[model samples]
Target: MAAYTVPKAFPTTVVGSYPKLPSAQEALRRQRKGEISEDEFKRLVREAIRGVIEDYIWAGVDILSDGEQSREDMVVYFAERLRGYAPGEWVRIFDNVYFRKPIIVGRVEWVSPMALDDWEYARSVSGGRPVKVILTGPYTMLEWSFDLHYGDRREAILDLARAIRREVDEYLARGAKYVQIDEPALSTRPWREEAELAGEALEVIFRGVSAKRIVHICFGRIERILPYILDYPVDQFDLEFKNSNFRLLPYLKEYGYDKELGYGVIDVHSLQVESVEEVKKAIDYLMKLDIIGPEKIYIDPDCGLKRLPRRIAREKLRNMVEAAKLARKEWAGEE
Candidate 1:
């Protein structure tokens, strides 16, 4: 168990996804339709991932991911690897986006490592940059799935928590310094009981894992559960801000948010690339608040950029990195 460290202030990163290339998407379609061999599809996917790594490097992003190129859907990808789960019908998450919801048919179990190979490949291509390993948290996994075996939701979530814990342990053993657990459903839980259970499950998931733990929540107001969630054992809270026009910062300041902040400075749902000036303005706004200093801040997009065009995604990241560098200078009184 070692502590995670960042090299400098306002480090630029992404919230773990890049847009899939059209050729990769077509290859996936062909593989699903049985039009191409599995080996061929995988070769195309590996090539696509290399291109994505290059995109991040070119954009000057300090932290990188595998771009999730091998994954069709976040929750379903892990469900397919774990035991006692089967893919169900497509369920709409939002506009034009859908995933085949997973159905839990029996006791959940971790059969083997799920994202290790992807993380290894990402590290190999990162050119010594720290690759952030992102995982869909247990609570989100259970919430998005149809649980038939564990009739009780709390029981099911805890079981999934243990399964995810195993995966996190494996990542830590393989030299992962930063591991993020995405639990967007934490913001949408309708009941206090569910929220409490989610917090407990998060504790279970990160138990005994020493990597820098981050939890990403997006697309919903977090003021209601921020108090409860802050108690979870994590090193940073990656949140959406640009989409809400920085409305949440004041609330976080008032509540005395003490953990490291993954400040989202770009909106991912839109194709319009934010100018460097716009991003700098957003960073300036946060700095003026004085709630968290530059050392505690991380700059990134509001969410994964998989929905946008590849060109737009790259441009957005490039601007974000530039803005962060400019802000870093201002923080040091160099500007």
Candidate 2:
């Protein structure tokens, strides 16, 4: 694997998902209720994915994805595909959102390649732009699922690390340039011991694969994980700063974080779209920090746009790209 380089300063991208088309969402519900055939559900999912990819291209996003339209939830999607996991009762994650929690009934195993086809399809439709292959990290997958089989949590996480690595290897073999491991649960861990264990699990997952490794951790006070997380073997850290009002930047600078930074300038949790100027302001503030250089910065939304309206997600991405262009010009001293 070659060194991953940023194409340009403030290159705009997304954090994996775009809002699912309403029809696609309905197809998911119908499929779950057995009201629709599996073939019918997959056809609608493909259509939704293609439309989302088109939106990304139209919005001028620098890096693209398949919008994760085929997935209901990140962890559960993989759980459904991987062996040794059984769906339990629906559990509430937040207000009005629920998922069937996964229970580990046996040793976790990777029966086949997951997301490789999705990556291939996304790359085919990307108009030659790099498409990021995203997956739920081992630590997050283990943390999110109930461990009824593995007696020790550490053992379970490590097993998951091995299982997910197989999927990563397949993605690389199929020509994925960038791969992001979504580990949002890392920040919210109740104990530092768990965080340490999670770090070890990351090493197991990331050791030697090497294709521009990125870890996206969001929605929690990252200050807790800090310099420890910086030690993880990854090229770049994709994180949420907009939702936290860029509070982590000071900590990052204080801790002397030296890796490439994926800065989030748009808040995905809100319906209100950020203006071009507002987005530019966020980027400008980070540029002035001097800790992360312009060449190392990649701009994106705070997190996935799955909860927001589809039109709003598209508009937000357009604003993000426009902001990046203006920021690039300013950094390059162009009028």
Local accuracy by lDDT, each model: 0.86, 0.85
Tens-digit lDDT track of model 2 for 1-335: 33333356777789998898866798788988999887788778777877888999889898888888878899899999999999977889999999888888999989998777667777777778788999998888887888899989888988898898888888878767788989999888736787788788778767887688899999997888886777888889999999999999999889998898889888999999999999999988887888877778889998899999988988999999998889989985532
Give candidate 2 regions above 4 Å deviation: 1-6, 35-38, 333-335
Each candidate structure's TM-score, on Cα atoms with residue i matched to residue i, is 0.94, 0.94
Candidate 2 lDDT score relative to the true structure: 0.85
Please report how far candidate 2 places residue 188 from its true position, in Å: 0.6
lDDT per residue as tens, model 1, 1-335 = 23324447998888987888765787778977989986787777778778899999899898888888878888988999999898788989897878899999999999999878778887888788888989998889988899889999888888898999889888888888889999888888746676789889889978777888899998787777777777778889999999988889888888898889999989998889999999999999998998888888999999999989899999999999998889989884533
TM-score of 2: 0.94
lDDT, model 1, position 293: 80
